[model samples]
Target chain A: MIVGDLSRRELADRLAGEGLALQFGPFNLRIRSNLGSFASLAHQLYEPYPLPEPAAISDFHVDISAPRGLRRWLRRQACFGIDGQLPFAPYTIEHAFPALEWGINWCVATRAHHLLLLHSAAVERNGRAIVFPASPGDGKSTLCTALIHSGWRLLSDEFGIVRPEDGMLLPIPRLIPLKNQSIEVIRKFRPEAIIGPSFLETRKGTVAHVRPPVESIRRAQEPARPRWLVFPRWVAGAPFTLEAMPKSQAFLSVATNAFNYEVLDEIAFRLVTEMVRSCDAYSLVYSDLDDAVNALDKLSQASDG
Target chain B: MLVSPLADRLIWQEWDDIYIVYQPAAAATHVFNETTVLILKCLQQGPLSMEVLRHQTEAALGVSQDELAANDFEFATTRLEELGLVEFVDDPSTAQ
Candidate 1:
């Protein structure tokens, strides 16, 4: 069953009562929430996701709800709890869905050490995937959003979960939260983008979420072998430039930028070295999205990884 | 005095001219330039003075030793010592 199959009342009821069991990529999350606002937004944004069996064991039991004490009655706030442990401070009540999204990402990135977790965005075309290792102001999510809308399949915008045993990228196509001005950028780029309500004064200044395309959500189980590592940045009025980076330098950047490079240790060294060796690495700078897209599309077609 | 490279404790990965060495004992990883890697390779034979290391590094990197090259050699070995990848040891011959 898909989330869209359920009515708003039914979705809310499932969330409040026994919890709503949903499959997010490889994870089975049984989300339990009592907040009406969170439920309404989640139902809208996650309508494309498939539901796991009600009796299936959940990898995580996540709670998004108002904190205890007078805070729940006055100037309301939301908190995230996983398996009875509150991992973060309370956010304003309206940021509950963002809290839920970010909380889930934290749970996976911190707990799932068995897989190589990279702070990157990945998208696939023709059985080949390109990974954009994320850094501050790198325009990773923006490029990922644009690519997915323009005929590429979205592997993920936040988590780059690679299976160490085989070096394949597992798709965890969740909500892509566009922050501040990027929200407007994406809206103008894709007029038909299914964005949830924008919440202001949250942690990331202002934020809005773009729902994953239904086709991408439906193909969540499909994993793609990574082919290219492109480090991208958006600079105002800069001409498009894509330059080859030395493999050793690429290794350092990718390893140091990973969320758990130290935790994995030798496995990280081996896999990262192999990944860089197998793929061509480049540094890209562009001001225009059209030029960026065309260049990447051309690269994907021109060479084999 | 001579410098000793702690090669026994390191895990080295090479791609082209650069090396990624992981010190499992310290749980630390470091990227080595060609010069640093060449110095470590030369020192693995035994502790060597800067004069001896300079000759070996020049041969390995295929460069003629001059003032600038010697300075770069000192810089590389200094970096190795800073990273605890190498240490100074008393030369046995001199002790005698």
Candidate 2:
């Protein structure tokens, strides 16, 4: 009900008293729950404009208003109506909106034509996209946060939705979630960065989110051709390094890490093959953000040269 | 009926300019260039004999018979068959 115009606190109260209704780009969602859990649901379901303060109280608890039996069914199926089509899962109440945004990211990812989802972080500057596809604890987010604060545009902090049809990296940039030392590391690097509240003792070890820069959000529709595929690893006390990886080996690495690669079938294979062929693949190991940024800058300059 | 029946079993995927398709269980793989995807999509409707495939491909892709030959259509057919996407179909009239 014209929900996008509401302020963060008003939106929170409205969602609590009434229900959750909001739109994110192309998708719209409505959730009905009691006041107790509505706060969490609200934060998760909507991207609070002019992002709320770090210590601001975020209400994450709400009670389901549906009948006991229907509630059980909704949970069991994990399905929710999106634009009237029942999606694979409901957007459950997350402690932070970033988590819910990630769910929305997953939702849009499946609908793209022949696009494979990759567990990576991508950032762009001057039309060139750099993808860091890696597993959890590989320090991709930390690297991405560092890059964005250093003037790179964040494409996405998690999934690298690569369209197989055109080999373009679609922008699905959201808040970059950081954990434990990464949060502190980024704070030291970019003190002005807007960070969400940290959910302590989470499975990912005290998780927090770095708000994506506004420029990235403004250019959300822009698609960039991947120029570098860097698989980063955080190694304590290691010198900042970038090593070239073989194309054949790089192909396997990317295919295995891709989210919807297998589902996209032949198109997935072709897109990845094209991407790997065109971009220079490297393995980056670092313990310091400054050193890593310097190394990336050198690479960027060389490409331009 | 003109396309190889074995072509049905083949799995082909092209991304950008590079193409790779293979049958793992059959232990066969084939690679093609940008032109192969157009060829595969044409054959996807059903198996076609080599002559018919060539003629249809010529019409669909707007290439001359000689140009089609230059693309190594015969080699592509063999590769597709090896990948199990196309196969030989018995002509019913001949059998009768």
Candidate 3:
């Protein structure tokens, strides 16, 4: 049964007990959290994801619970637990969803070394994926959310998992976290976009998550061959420009942006080299989302032809 | 004379003139330009003196020994050593 099939009470009961196993891209995560806000957000946001059967093996098991010690009673907070260890400090109860989101990303980034994990956004169209490897504040997620709403499938918003054996990009398809002004930008860009409540004064500054499209969630298992690697940066009032990036520069950019590039070592190098070699690399700067999306659409078409 | 060794677990790939070396033992990847890679390739054979490396690199790349700056070669070798790509080793002949 899909996660949407469970009633909110049922979902909460399962989460508060043995946990709820949900399929996320290629991995199945068993999440246990008693945080009421997290449960509500899951019911609202993860409506399209399939629920893993009771007997399914989970790749990572995590829990979110009330923090203990003097801080628990003094200023009540939530702590994320992974395999009996708390990897991060507690956050206020209002920021539970972001904490959970980040915790899941941490799990994949730190433990999943079998695949090359890039700190980037990935989207697919016409059976080909485009990877955006950029430093923070580069407007990757904003552009990614725009493209997804414009018809591209969201492969991932934070991590791009590339399988070394076949050079395929795995889809994580989780929430697209929007920070600060980008949240308002996306909200206005796509009026129908369902974004979670914004958590202000957090580490990332007014962070919210845009729910993944149902189609993306349904097609999470399908991997796409990478066709383009674009390093995008948004500058206000700037004319859109797309420039070719040298393969050598692209190689270093990708390696530097990868989360587990060092851990995967030889395989990571081979895979990233193959990826940069096969795809057209570019540096994209744009102010308008529509213009940016249109340029990418044309590029994808040119690639096909 | 400077002599260094390439790690055993390294896997090398060439893109144009750039070389990408993947060191599996350390789980680290390093990119080297053609000159740096050529020097490393020479070191892969065995330890070589600085003078020997100069002549070998000059011959391998068809460049004049006079045109090859000694400081640049020394700097590159030192950088490679810093990256753990190569290490100084005692020459058996020198010991004898």
Going through the candidates in order, their DockQ values are: 0.60, 0.06, 0.53
lDDT of 2 by residue, B6-84 (tens): 4435555444456566554454445566555566777777766667777777777777765677447777766666666
Question: TM-score for all predictions?
Answer: 0.93, 0.64, 0.91
Q: How many clashes (backbone atoms < 3 Å, residues ≥3 apart in a chain or on different chains) does model 3 have?
A: 1
Question: Candidate 1 chain A — worst ten consecutive residues by lDDT sum?
Answer: A296-305
Q: Rank the candidates by lDDT, best first.
A: 3, 1, 2
Candidate 3 per-residue lDDT over residues A1-305, each given as its tens digit: 78899999999998999898999998899889888878998898888889877788999999888876788789868888899899888888888888888999999999999899999999999999999999999999999999999899999989989988898999999988899999999989999999988899987899998998889989999999989999999999999999998888899999999998777767778899899989989999999998999999999888779
TM-score per model (chain B): 0.82, 0.63, 0.82
The best candidate in terms of TM-score? 1
Looking at model 3 chain A, which ten-residue stretch has the lowest summed lDDT?
A: A260-269
Worst 10 residues of 2 chain B by lDDT: B1-10
Each candidate's fnat, listed in order, reads 0.55, 0.00, 0.55
Q: Write the per-residue lDDT of candidate 3 for residues B56-94, one digit (tens) a residue.
A: 877777798766788888888889889887877766676
Please report how far candidate 1 places residue A31 from its true position, in Å.
Answer: 1.2
After the best TM-score superposition of candidate 3, give how far the Cα of residue A143 lies from its true spot, in angstroms: 0.7
CAPRI grade of model 3? medium
